[model samples]
Target: MTEALEIRNLHVAIEDNEILKGVDLVVKQGEIHALMGPNGTGKSTLAKALLGHPDYEITAGEILFKGENIIEMDVDERARLGMFLAFQYPVAIPGVSVANFLRTAINAHRKAADPEDKGISIPDFRTLLKAKMDLLEMDHQFAGRYLNEGFSGGEKKRAEILQLATLEPAIAILDETDSGLDIDALRIVADGVNSLAGPDLGVLIITHYQRILNYIKPDFVHIMLDGRVAESGGPDLAEHLEEHGYNWLREKQSKATAG
Candidate 1:
């Protein structure tokens, strides 16, 4: 069977400045992989590139989803193919209600899959949205409010996870979901992710801190540095990073460069 997402020797640049230098990764269904790195190390760049963000140009390498190269696909095309990205900083749409936004997205996906379909009915959409909101422990009022408008940090993060739950993407890339969140908020977000993790979904969590891993244990841990993935290992690698920090990885990279 084809893998969920396979990135081979991926290279990305923005405005002629290369950010991701030959990144190779494979995420299979039912696995969670954490890409941990320091600030400005191209972690977020990698996430954006995978989602086909126009700003980050993919100068080289291939991104294959389910055995087909998606490097040339557009952002909406990729999303329609069951790939979802939860942004590090989610933008607010002042006039769009959360319920309407979700319904439109869900209907788009449905239409893409079956061109003959008329889209989800209002009654069915409400039931589905309510169930997803309950699963995420969000209030019904959240659905009626404008998307991410005037939401607190915790609320924003929760809203992102709610999108993930509602979309049910095959591969979900959460870029720094733990950023700007407190302990309680972090746990809630983690719980939301944990609930959705199963045989049908794969997750790529890009983060700089190991605190989130304490709740959402990853099956594999990777460390990116200087625009490349320097090391990869099991969950213990995250524990090591938590205890020591990135100094060891930096020293190792320095020696490799000097050699």
Candidate 2:
């Protein structure tokens, strides 16, 4: 069965500040969805909460991944359940080669599933890593480099996609993957995401702008306002957003409510 990620009336807050009031969204495998909103509108908060971030407290509602409630699960458990988050600013982890880091992570997930199941062999890992790298058109030497060490902004984002490609999560939540990327870099990253998208993977791309959507082509476009989805439509909605901007939507929505 195709996996589904459903969020119902989610309210998340950190310390004394409430970021998400009541947001609802559902993403199904094989579908690409874009969640667009202005900055400080709880986009990243939703992403973190979905990942089961300890800092964010779930004040209300549920996050059901593949029909399982993951509100109380740990971050690793979320990953095992097929949830992945690509950060806007990925920190560099020095002294760890990209291949080694990924191998360790994959083995950890395998061990988590079955303590008795031995980890993937080095040869098998090399084969798998090469396949994923080739799919993303990455240089074979990339795997030998230290993770994010002396990498450009685009390289960091590409590395994140490589992780995504290797892990093959069911639901991929990208929190502003386009941030700090030039047009050329953005296209390459988008191409990587596009190549990986298919029947077994659901993508929720959260961003403040619509440029990425031009390349990614989301099946559904959602606009969030004040922590809730204010409107949803097809790809044209994103085009409309590009032409007019969120202020226009806010005014139109306000007038609709007043009327």
Candidate 3:
């Protein structure tokens, strides 16, 4: 079966306020698409809704994964179905070690895929975890630390990317992964993402700035404005946004609305 994520005429609302006004998009495996826009344009809302966040209500629309409607699927169910979201701010789990959390998650996926097979053995799990950590350039000791607890901003983001690496999802949505990172940290995290980009993975990178694109070049660039995609083009479109900002797009959207 062809692996793809398709969003058709998605409309999302938080509380009584509608955020995403009719949005449509499709992401296939082995592709990277960057959704860029100013704050409050519902970039994050679209990402959250796609992942089935309870707070964001999907007033109308459909989210299809592998040609199946997944709007009703629970978050864990989506994760188990090879969908991942790397949050902008990773939450701290005070007691759970990174290794423990990943092992449990991996086992859950394994068991879901096959009912009879037992979860990965401890030694084997450790080896697999270590290999993934190394692929992300993370130290072996990093797994011993509690998941995101007391981790620096960089560490938290890197840990999120590590989870992405280990899970190897078919579609990964990065919600502002570059939100809070220094130059070095940004490069590190971007490099980690770059390393994981391949035929098996399709990534949706949501960001406000074009800086992150410099490292993980997107195959298509989309500009979101007022809860809808205003314009979309190749990498050059991002460079245009970098130089002119979103004012032009906002004006264009306004004119179109008036017309």
Candidate 4:
């Protein structure tokens, strides 16, 4: 099984502060991996760095996508190469409608898939948008509303998944998508994500709580502490963290690094 995205001894820093220290992971096609950790453990930083966030400096290591080293690839270049990240806090663009935003992004993905193929036609774009919106349970009016201008927490999260469905990226990093969602909303978002699961999509789910794991059921679970991945296991790891919390894992990680 080929990995969709593989991080090799990745070390990321911001300004003078190091965040991710020698982290390594792999998300193979059709696999869902959960990244669970306490805050400031570099989970979000890893997602941002993979997306080539400007503030993040890759001080060391490599990110390989489909056997290509993307350490120096620009953010847009990475997106064009079938990488997507669902931000924990989505941005609100007051003037751009959700429909327009999605259409542009889908077209961009299409253009990248085939540089010679022209963008999606307006009628065709609308049809595709309606189909995805229906899958997310978004109202038709949502298509005309400004991007997250007044969306509730759940709405924003679902909107992010909508984009994911439309883009169909090979690898997706979902950053705390369950942060503000109620149980009902979390289920909906998880369903939408699950609908996209197959032989082509690999997901990296980053979260602090395991409640969402109960809904999404990751195949592998990783515990991140301090500034690196401390331990990894099957879904049972999530249950263990939920029961005992991070204190023990933090201590274990500290002792391991100390030795």
Q: Each candidate's lDDT (Cα)?
A: 0.94, 0.93, 0.93, 0.91
What lDDT tens digits, residue by residue, belong to model 2 across residues 74-151? 999999878999988887899999999999999888898899979999999999999999988899999999999999
Clashing pairs in 1: none
Using all chains and alpha carbons, the TM-scores for the candidates as numbered come to 0.98, 0.96, 0.98, 0.96
Best by lDDT: 1
Q: Write the per-residue lDDT of candidate 3 for residues 21-132, one digit (tens) a residue.
A: 9998999999999999999999999988999999999999899998889999999999999999999888998999999999999999999999987999999998899898
lDDT of 4: 0.91
Task: For model 4, name the residue pairs that clash.
Answer: none
Give candidate 2 misplaced runs (Cα > 4 Å): 256-259
Clashing pairs in 2: none
* Model 4 agreement with the true structure over 1-259: per-residue lDDT tens digits: 5557999899999997998989999898899999999888899999999999999999999999989999889999899888999999999999999989888888787887798978999999999989998888888898899998999999999899998998888899999999999999999999999888888999999999888987898999998877777889999989989999999987886787799
- Weakest 10 consecutive residues, lDDT, candidate 1? 1-10
- Indicate the residue-level lDDT of 157 in model 4: 95
**What is every candidate's alpha-carbon RMSD to the true fold?**
1.0, 1.3, 0.9, 1.3
